[model samples]
Target: MINITFKVTVGLLATFGCYILFQNKLIANNVFAGQTEEINQNNNEVSEQTNGESEIDVVNFNRPISPNPVHVPGWYFVPGFITQPMKEYNVHLKNDFQITAKVGLNNTASSGFGGNYFSWFVSSDGVNWDKVSQNKHSRDTIDTSVLTDSSDTEGVRYYQAYSEVQPQVFNKPIYSEIATVHFIKGDVNATEIKVNTSKDYLVSNPNFDQYISASAITQPKGATGRVIWSSSDTNLATVDPYTGKITANPNRKTGTVKINAEIINPRYMRNSNVFGYKELQVKKMLEIDGETNFQNTVLFRLNPDFDLSKSKIEWFQKLDNQVHKFTNISDQIISKEIKLQDNNSEIYAVITPLDIDDKPLPNNATESNHVKIQVKDMPPGANRNVHIRQSLSNISIYGNSENIGVHQLLKHKITFNDDSETYGYNDDNVDGNLRIPISINETNIKIESIPSGYVPDYRIENDGLHQDIIFENFPIKRHFGFDLIVSTRVDKIIDSSFDYNPVYKYRTLFNTDETVIGKPVHAEFSTNTIEINPKDINFGEHSKLEKDDVNREQDLDNEKFVDIRDKRIKYSPISLFVSSSGFQRKGAPVRNVPITLANYDENGIEISPKGNYFEVASSMNNSPLKSVFWNRKQGLKLKFNKLNFPDGDYHTTLYWTLEDSINSQTK
Candidate 1:
């Protein structure tokens, strides 16, 4: 949620009088007015009884609960009377109400307040306080007629008072009640029908995208009445009839507009101020946008609409406590050494508009929108993501799927912004088609699926030494599925850091004309080795051959051909070779009628027979994935007369050798 807080006005008592107040033992005053002599004599005893605050940590100590007002005779405003919880007032321009704190003297010899010090303080938000009024010789009244509030729109304010007597009489300082005041615009209860309206306003959004909010605070707080609004010049600005919001005319470059709001209540008497008009100055709104780089180093920029020579920019940073402003730490907008307490802090800019002559504009300045950022503080180009990973539910068809490690899948959610806006990794994204141009870089990866918009078609084609996936027409939406294929540098097991050899490569493109190198997409992989089944081959029996059979061929079923499961996730150049010994008839001596022996590769292609061995189907560099090597005809073959050799379930053992990693030589 993005929230904006405007300026607030404060009262003199709250801002100039609120300060440190020490809580000590309360001193009861002498009820008898004639005990002035005895009271003076007991001053030492009173001072000794109330000096316990010396041991207390005043700033951090728990504030004593606001005691219910004691109506006892001499406690006067010991709770220092500012205002009560039920008090309400109006400060139209400035009300003449005098806020005073009366301290009832303790039972001392003197009946009158002679020697004492008094201080008053005020606060808008309860947590922060400011001193507003102070005096010696026991003066305690605050004339609010000259005081203005922190905000012209907000009416609530808080006040507290501290008082102490001199000459060691009743050594304890007096504490005041936290006074709450709800102010209506003017003395509406005493006037005729008058609506709450400010005296001046600045309409900064020249495009009229922003509105001037009219505050509806009435005389009686939540008074049941409707307000009607009007503008003096339609070309300069217009007011919403029902909402009372004022919008500047976008067509008009510069001008002054007057806004009038009328309250229809007829109970109060009429006055000239009842129809007071609010003046608005039309100007361009200054805006600031912020973005983070690689989750570190926040970058901020002002919109180009701003005229730098005539306007000055000031930057402010607010944590939970609004303490630091960027301009205070450094004059330059960019400060690498600025401190950020956490990711929750927000930074914003206040632009003071100046005229052609370099003088400030009257009644108005624009405040830019604020942003929150997370700074990892890494230099640049560092990918701190633990792994390329995602979690998807259910299963579907495999366009190009494998049992890859779970962490290898990159489930991406990208948001496109206008070319003018800057964005960093993992920043908040809204719906747009062409923001930052991003390309889908797939390293043996695939586009599994997506939630919305377009996902680049991860098209694979061979390019030089490594394979690359080209992201064609890839303008991404919110969420898209990018998957991976098993392509390793070599047939070796890898874990932890998977920056080893990669058989395929991928990257992003910017509008076809520009390109920026993206962060490394790394993953962790488990070691998988080539495996083969140790099963025997069986050829069905064939009938005896006649003289004419010597010219005919024979068919043999090598039941259960060579089976291999290439568990290796990465590609390694390897091939399976084969050889066979002569066929041996059980009870008869070994004989040969020219037997043809064979072993198949994963694709069932017979290994090419060299003097004794054959080369089976090779690898996936040319094809895709073929893991086994063996054919159904991988058994002894004969084309001779029955007289040449007797066929009594003759069999031969075919020898197989595997060079699982032929390209690299070993294994």
Candidate 2:
């Protein structure tokens, strides 16, 4: 058969071989052959075993399983079981029984069936097992494309997958661990201080030597350095440069003091520092009462002990509404008084320190108080009289009685004198006094006499005289009346005298009975007649005619006058003898009758020659009539009839004439 058969068979075998070849070709074409087949088959056997183990009663087995069923060891059942090497089996078996495991082909018995593998199982009881994966395994390299599904089974221990299972090994499990980190902190330091001053000082220049300390903690990277100060900062104090101490000027203004401190780093951080303050002190000055009165020693003063060396002082006064420098008074004492003029009305004073230009010193200046003084009447007695006088003898007139007719004329005179003794008089007599009087005295007086046949029958009328006198006369055909007047003390009289006579010649005849007749007849016959020897007469100082002279002149001449003329005779017849008739009556005386013889011769008788004849004739008397009379006298008198004569001059005349009968003519 081999040959025939080989032929046939061979042919057939060839055909079969061909067929086998074709079939091999077909099988090779249709399925993996050889190692692929063996791989497949090993894979199928692993699947079967795994399936069989999955079907095994895990309750009946005695091994324990993990509580988390979905979690499983990743490196498990990586090789076929029956074909696994003993070491691999032992390794897998030991890991399955223990809690921790390492798996590889050299340690497990089934490792040669492929590489190495381990079992992953599910169990409800510790002794029973249900295969989750079997004998096909991979290493620990993660597969990004593989996913786990626990949905179909409950109480699943592990989620797992198989590696390409020609031989098997498994991967190991991983665990987590713990870690730690670190940081740091910061700090700060700060401080403050205070100081005091004395009352005597005006300003404090605290030197840097006197210091007040300050301290505090600060932030680590915070500000740290020397502090600076100003009047503006917030939380720090100012320090003196010389003393290195902190103090305020007493005159320092009240307000906030700002301070600042900063660390000198490339980066700067500023810390604000400040403090607030006020000054403590008592201030003073002055006012004056009466500045004008403070002359000489007056003064004002501050406290006596005040030190002028450390301070300056000056003074001034206000005058004329302006301030004037007191050049006179300047000293350390705060008080002074100005020496004022006596007439000054107002003044004021003020004081200040020399060092300070604007500040006034305390209790330094004042004003003073004023006074006023008043001004006292002038004498009444001292004056002398004037006197005047007049006289009255400077005016008068006189005349004879006959040629001036029976009227005669007289005269008057006047004069004046003064008797007052005083220059002026206060009395009625014009005597001595301051007051004088008015005087009236006689200045003149005058007189006029009336004619012989006319009388001035005068009487005193408004008489200013103590007495009055008057003169009167009749018409005697020849004489006028005479009067006399005088003024003296009450009854004194003054006398004057004058004589009077007729200017015509005339004669008068009177009978024995003193009858005036025409004329005397015979020259030898007796008659009465008067004779005036002078035609006129002046009776010098003798005022009266003697009675003997008047009678002697009248008896010298006396005469009688008669008329004898014609006679006739006739014859008578009766013849009687008449011769003897008267014889008896005159017998003795008539004895001689001589005429008888003449008669006898009657017719023719011539015989009478020796005898004379008888005859008759006329006669006259021739002599001047003489008379004497007073005319006027001197004195004061009044004429009531002539009172209206206006106190001036007047005159009148009176006359008488005689006629002769025998001659039929006037004489």
Candidate 3:
């Protein structure tokens, strides 16, 4: 009975197994046939579409796979096991003629499933498709250059990312929504490199378009190309490497320079070169008063034809066969008045052109014309007044109208009507009034005395220092002569050795809002020397160190003065600092020492016994500072700190620093 039962069970089991195998085989065949039919249908449509149109070369891509479907347990088919479809993707054409497809994967758990392969395909006609040959995997991106040859065609091409998985059960491949990219015919070669500039020359210093540009022939008619700009002479001009713009050098001379613009990749064209020059020319001629005699004035003017926006103008007076150059002359105005000197004099002008940076042009340049004038001595005269010894005449000339630090005194003496022929005059006149032309820098003149029965009239011309004093025509004159003194004051100190000594004599009118005398106000140490020598301190071996005063005064002649100090700070006092290198016993280090200053005053005065010593500066661990007023009389009294001393003749070096600055003064 048991044997019979076993044979029956085996037969039934074999029948059941055969039924399951047959069903799986039928399902697999159906899935394969469905895929084959779809592929064949697409190929037939592509063939029909290409009958009259251009044919695209398609590359076949295939991946090896087992023919039989793998078996999976029913538990493996979880609720979310289905592969999710891609949401979004795009195709791009790179500069290197490669096509890149970017795909966005679905953020689902099934994204990590096996056989999550994506097969990318492209088609000129929407019906025809060919798989891309590169990186056909489960990645989110695929790049191929196969379609680059067709990128020149004028039409739309379609692409699709077909997703498939090696599933245990037979199923159709999942297809994503189609994406498209449009390619229009393009002419990529650049044919010409044309260089263009707004202007050929640089006038003065302009911040406009002082550069050159370049364009080339492309598919789009007005497309720009990558160009490199260069200059033939860097000293004369320079060009920006990437901007293709040109600029004149700051110290460029009056000459021409060549500018070149070349295409970075000159496939179908050549480069371009242009000639540029500086817009420099003396448009107006120098004019001056031709002739003048003693007590007369000469006028010099420059026409506003030349561009002075970046140039400097200088006036010169040639007197007594010596050329004297005028300093601090107006750079904004074109006219000037000169006073006649007491000698044969000639007045002229010098114009210097500047580059964009306001630096002088390389070549030495000047523009001017000379005017002749005569200055005569006094003629023999008996009625002339010589009793009035030097009368004081005060006048405000160039410089701040406000109170300045100090004014320099300029004095001049003049004797008139001594001799008519001395000034190139042949006729001797009895009733002649002498006219005295004053210099731009001369503010006032003093007269010794007026002739009897003769009154003097002072006349000013054009709101300037130019003036004429008319004396009553000498009555019963026998070559009358008079003594005259001229003097002026300047805020800045004048040094006799300066090449432009006359510059300090005149005030600056360049900027009316900031008019200054010769130089601005400033203060500094009395001398550049930093070492200070103090009186030796003597103490008995048994006596402890005691503080003492070292009376010291800065030499006014070498102290803070105008034109010699920094002129940046307007209203501020200078700072005085004192430091020491400790005390040395017998020229060897003994102990740390400190000192102090007291009774500081601008005027050098000895402090009274009852007077308190000022704690202005001290040489303690810290270097103490003190304020030094500019207007106050400055003096110093040094004090030493009390300390036990090793009595082998202690010595120390002191450093005194007077700094003129806003920060130092505030500290």
Candidate 4:
């Protein structure tokens, strides 16, 4: 009986084992279908969550379906539905443009059990679904991928997930509600960003306001991201963070400064170090100050607040729109005596800033306004108020007072043919001074007249063309008028042979060869003649007298032959006269005029007995003639001597010569 029982039990156990094996194979073959159905249902639920718009879920229908396997008797049973299903899910995006979906579950620990898994789905549209990836167990989160469709246009990607689960009572897959996300379809390429408004800007005020701008030529026009502004030298300038406006720093020195702008977009320029940069140069203005109109000396200076040590300055003169550069200049204030031309004009200053190394800074040169130079008065000789006086006077004949001294006077009037006239009494009130503010070398006056007597005597004070005259002292008065006197005194005897034809010439002392020949002052006097009436030398009656010393050693006899003698006699003095009309006045002094006489017996040969030949009317030395005295007269004394001789008519001619040697040693 035991044997029979064992056979039957063993056969039954074998049959049961085979049966379990076949069922396991069947579950394994059918599990996939159930999981697929659960996934479809999950997708439908996800579609419901997405506003009831169902998406065409494409799956790998060719993939093998699987079934759940039964456990053996006495095997431990662990519940696959330990955690609840996920209800809602959301898709999140990061800065790197990474998208991920998180499913909301009642139980946070929602790992799938049995032959189940979790899958993520993505689609360009709700109609066509594309598989992203599948996980072995359903989880709370899953990563996703967004790609470009056949067209290059980027579309909003619709996303969904499926959680294949095995509940204690059912075996299927469930899907969470769809979480849609819009992603960029193509690769991120940084737009070429450039800093606009990059140029040198002029700063008028100490605080200057400038702006910087940026541009991108890529996919999005306005979404280039945050813009940042920076300055290469903060001491020179500063820029605003939010606004790209640039401003000069406080107490900023004038120079060239650089500014930069950048973009902070990761999607676009991810690998680029520099986004957009530009060199914005800052410029400051220069100015000049001080007086514009000037007479002799002027002071001009530059306005401060600029680095003059590292700068260059130039001065220019502008006349009739023409520019002329001044070779001599000072960087700062300039005080100099200026000479203005006859025309009207102006001057200007140009300043240029330089770099540290003394190079000209770019776009930093400036020019100043024109300063005018003008004169205030008119020039000399603008009118005709000057003239020369012409008159003759002083004539008298001297005779023995016992003879009633006869006198004759003749007044000669002279007329100047040229405009070289003298200042008349009518010109006393007119102004003849030079009014122009310039230097004058010389001026002239001409006097003319006719006379018949002694030449006028005159002397000039300060040498020739006196340099003591300058613009500082003007309106020089020239006195050419004078008084004349001519008289013959009986007390003096005139030499009949005296000659007065001496010429006084004017010459510049600087060069003896150079003479003021043709100028206003030239030769001055004419010839003069002296006449004397014949007079007899009388010694009462002739007397005879004896000289007792013939041969005193032989016989001192009073009876010796006697000799007769008469004393010599002196004649009355005669005088010569001179008038003002014959005088010549050089604006300067004249040298000593000499008088010489040559005695002859009507022959040109000089005779002997120099003392008896002739006597001079006057002697001269190195002294100059006085100008104040208009007339001069001098007398010559003649004496007679008698010797024992026979004579009928003894006549001798005296030649007289006068010379005017102007000073040649003037300094």
Candidate 5:
């Protein structure tokens, strides 16, 4: 009873709540409520049926259109049929959608609308369509256009097929990016210029006019060229512009002249090349008054006759200040005389070529030739006075002989020849201070000069000046003489004093007594006699002994004295001999024999007879006596403890006087 009453508001609210619940369930289950499974199945079957029918319908439609109809999009066009031959047709999809088109007549259909060939076209907007044909058309048959469709759900863009008969349809407008380039310029200016001479130039006469040719100017890039030449301040040199030649004046003085080369180039400015200056040495032929006689007056002349047109002569004198001053003389070919102030002085002349400015030309100027003079003196007198003197020519007797016994005296005197009446008295001065004593028997003294080759006019006198020159007791014999070759004139005078006889004395006495019997006795004696003469003596008068005359004599004397002493003997042997005879008698008949004899016997001994037997006789005889004498004397005895004697001859004379007194008286 309580549930039967209901409100309209509550009912509505309940209905709304149920609707919200059902929407939520539907959202959660992800399902659709309006369409059932059966309905979906039925719809799918219908779709299959419709597809089958559509496919069939399409097949039928394609068959009726042409036997090989190419299906394209839903809207396609075919060209009108003509008598042209049929060409093949190809269809391609656009945006993955199938599209086909054909224009060929089919025998089965017997009704084709267009020509035999067909082309396809595609466009996403459907306005600008591109043909897609298989023919030789510009457009490609394969789809290349990008298609967009409103019904396509996928966000994919792709190319559609397009073909055209003309190649212009594929080419389109194209633009390249913009770019820029730059460049710079380099320098091309010229720098230097050079110039030179062409050939050798002669500066002499007769082609002395030869000129030095100028060479062409060589300039660097971008420059104009010109040349100008100027010589040194003196106008001796000049150059011609047209011929490019440098010429020298023949009359120009000899010296170095500078030549300037001016280069006229616009780019190089006023540049100049200064060539080495040419040297012009002057030359000329000139002669002085012969070189043989450099003294006295001198003359100067020009060779080849010194023509006035060729050369001129100039005179110059050198002063103490070393300056050459000009003289007042004008001559070229003519000879001019010059006087020298002093005999030992020198004079000179200068020659110059006759040309403009009196300049010295090449091979023309001659240096001044010098000359010197000499002087002589006076003569001597005719008659002259002279005197002669005696000097030791030599003392050679002792020089050659060493034995004192052979030493001889030698003397030499020198004389002079006297000229003119101024002669004085000649005297013999002994020059005793210079004299030498000798031990010789004889000596020849002479007065002579030293040497020959002198003029002779006077004589020499050999007075007592060369006195008794003697040499004694010399051991060896030698010859001695003086050199009479007078060094000057001498007067010949001879004088001499000599002792040629060397005397020796000797004496001896003998006493003898003898005993014993008769036997014939004999005594023998011998003696030594030394004979020395003037010929054995030498006085050392030879030239070789003149150096030591005094010493020569002394030495010889000492040697001779030693030899004499050695020859003297003392108590030499005196031979004595005695003889005796003895006899005995037999005693008769036993009778006693008595014999008596004297005890001492002086001379001959006697025998006496007595008694009965014949007396025995005995006699004693005295020996003869002999004494040895040296020369004429008994044995000479010289006693000396010690003596030093040289080897030489000692000349000594000995006389032996023998006295023998022996008497015998027998009774």
Candidate 6:
């Protein structure tokens, strides 16, 4: 007689000491932190606690309900619990999943009848049945060929087996647990991972984009590729998990960061870890920024990526819409003095980017955005396409006044513009004072007049050394200056044998080369005969809005300029008179702007000589003669009242004369 024993499933709860034990099935022997629950499978109330998002169902059968209970007889049966292993993942049915029924054959059991062999049964629904395989070998464990079809692709499937023997009335089959297991198209796990970067290296700057991409090889027909990216040091750089794009911290000067990418589908292989990594060089991009400060300088700054000692910089200036090459300033130096022509123009910088090791980057050079340096309210004479041509004349005269600034011979005027109020006037603490150094190389000369708001300070004197009449608290604010009559007198009987001419030189805030700041240029004044050269003052194109003041470059083509040639004498000589008739349009009776000519050298005397004359300059001498000259820049500057005239070419005549000393005549 043949004998048969039973195979037990693992960890099955025994309701009446007859249920089976199953692995991966809910088990909470000792009360844990989670909420406790009772297992009741008959009512379909079963709970499985796990870390994964999904759980598989294990079928438990009632021993009393089944006519063919889960048992094999060796003429008798022993009650026990059976437990079987279960998987948490969606068990792939397309792959090999063997449903083997294990039964032990007793060598000699005299107790008689036993189950013959094992037969396998399958089910689409849990309640239905279909016998798909039979165990032909009488030997012990039998394998069932459980081939999955497309219909079994979703949900759990049921597989079970029962052993048969000669006269097998007591040998009944108990279904194997839930689909021995459900079907998946194929293995969906990622086998390997590959990552790629857009560029070989990275330039670390917040403004530029850093990019990387990844792909995973999932061999399953229906499986989609997945990618998970990470950065070794998130403080320095970070990579997106799905997109693999990177963003670096701007404050990080220079550093290396490792990028990692991996992908694995939990459905097929939870323990399979496939990944790839690439070491990227984070280099710094060179950058620059520029601004124009109140000190009239363009300051350039560089990013901290380069060694300033080795990385030099060059500056360029754009004037009149044309780019021009500028001086290449030394590295580590930032400030550049702005020129007069730099008003309303663009300035930019180009630097060759370098690494900390003093090596140039792959892209050597970079340029900063064009910094438009707009120097506002630039002096009328301090810009291109328009000018206020004026200069200080060399003073040559014979005088015997006691004080210096109070005399006519050494008199100088520093006139403020008509629009001086446009700029704010601050106190001495804010806007500093103006210092004028009067270096007289001769002797027996005294300062005659020190204008009220300004006085000489810090007078330094040494044997045969220079002198400075410093104006300590001149009280003039920024862009606020007035016609300062700087007058001084000379002794009547001191060194008349040599030439005598003292020039009051004060370098204005703007450059003296481009604009005549101190004196009218290119004129030789002779102390002999009298003459005058008045150039045709062609105030260039003017819009109606430009009613401020003198803002035009004169016509240089006119071979005419005004000259006052006065022969030096000790007082009481003659008086020079000036007058002008209002200009009228050529061949038309319509009048133009009324003339409000200001003669600054003569105490800032402004006259609107409609039809009369005004005495402008005089000395104590009864006889006066020759080679003293004046141009628009030297002694004559015109400032008109509010302009309310029509546009037209206008002409006017200016009259000047020197009164005769003996016959009371005028020249």
TM-score-based ranking = 1, 6, 3, 4, 5, 2
Query: Which candidate's lDDT is highest?
Result: 6
Stretches of candidate 3 off by over 4 Å are 1-226, 231-240, 247-253, 258-450, 453-480, 484-667
**Candidate number of the best TM-score:** 1
Compute each candidate's TM-score over C-alphas: 0.22, 0.14, 0.20, 0.18, 0.15, 0.21
Worst-scoring 10-residue span by lDDT in model 5: 8-17
Q: For residues 567-615, could you state the per-residue lDDT of candidate 5 as single tens digits?
A: 1111222211111121122332322222111111122232222221121
- Tens-place lDDT per residue, model 2, 505-595, is 1111100011111111110100111111211111222112221111111211221111111110111111001111111113233332211
Q: Quantify all predictions' global Cα lDDT against the true fold.
A: 0.38, 0.20, 0.34, 0.31, 0.25, 0.40
Count of backbone clashes, every candidate in sequence? 41, 144, 22, 25, 107, 69
> Which tens-of-lDDT digit does each residue in 1-667 have in candidate 6?
1111111000001011222222221121110011111122342433342212244354443211222122211111311113222211234443333332333222122125543444455565545677663342234332222222223355655555444433444334332333234355443544544444533344444333333222222223223224466888775667666435555554434467777877545544657766777666654443324444334655554434333333335666675557886665645335666554455666565554344355654354444335466554454443211112223333653332221221234433444332222222211211223433333423333333224544445353534434444443333333433455544443232222222222232223332222223333222222233444434555566665566555226423322344444423333466667666766767787555664555543233444442456555565544443333444443445565667766666667766655645433233
In model 4, where do residues sit more than 4 Å from their true spots? 1-188, 202-204, 207-223, 267-270, 287-667
Residue 423, model 5: lDDT of 18
Ten-residue region with minimum lDDT total, candidate 4 = 7-16
Rank candidates, lDDT, best first. Answer: 6, 1, 3, 4, 5, 2
Judge candidate 5 at residue 504 and give its lDDT: 15
In candidate 6, stretches whose alpha carbon ends up further than 4 angstroms from where it belongs are: 1-409, 413-453, 460-468, 477-487, 491-516, 520-667
Q: What is the lDDT of residue 170 in candidate 1?
A: 35
